[model samples]
Target: MGQGETEKIAGELIRQAVMLLMDRNEDITLSSVLNILADFQMRAFNTGQLNACIQAIADVSAAKSGSLREESALKDKVAGKCSSCRSSDNVTTLH
Candidate 1:
């Protein structure tokens, strides 16, 4: 899929996910995300849409003018940050 189409799908997914979350009584959960992804996926055996969604996320993260870039900068500017993010960065995948 083209970048534009990917972006549109991403936007729609985000909108739906936020609504899904708001309808829930819990603090946070990935169930909504999973539900939305299940719909976006192609055949049960094909992960093409999921992979495209990942690429779409990376594209937005790499953009110079997006909220992600702004969030990154804000994260760096904060002092005495928690270790959750740092710990996540330290994760090592066994090959």
Candidate 2:
């Protein structure tokens, strides 16, 4: 298609995506819209913008997921430990 035709189609897609998110009570931020468009592109074109940045996005997501997992595990390990169990008298702070 011509550039103009492609742009018009993209504009309509954006409007539809935004309205769909609004209807679903989803957040309407740039990231939300872009994510929707990314999914649509995957469905319609089988690929697009993500081709350029997929590796970077994957790296970031994986790193954050690992960090969150570690944080959760640490919380689980540290929980239920009350330093205020006392030395038979006063309380102790867990620093």
Candidate closest to the true structure, highest TM-score = 2
Report, for all candidates in order, the number of backbone clashes: 0, 0
Q: Cα RMSD to native, each candidate? A: 11.3, 10.0
Task: Quote the positional error of residue 71 for candidate 1 in Å.
Answer: 8.7
* C-alpha lDDT (0 to 100) for residue 9 of candidate 2: 62
Estimate, for each residue in 38-68, the C-alpha lDDT of model 1 and write its tens digit: 5555422435456655644454344524656
Off by over 4 Å in 1: 27-48, 55-95
- Model 2 per-residue lDDT tens digits across residues 1-95: 44455555666677777799999999986567667766666666434333323433343346557878777755644563434454523333333
TM-scores vs. true structure, each candidate: 0.38, 0.47
Compared with the true structure, the alpha-carbon lDDT of candidate 2 equals 0.58
- Model 1 gets an lDDT of 0.52
CA deviation > 4 Å runs, candidate 2: 45-95
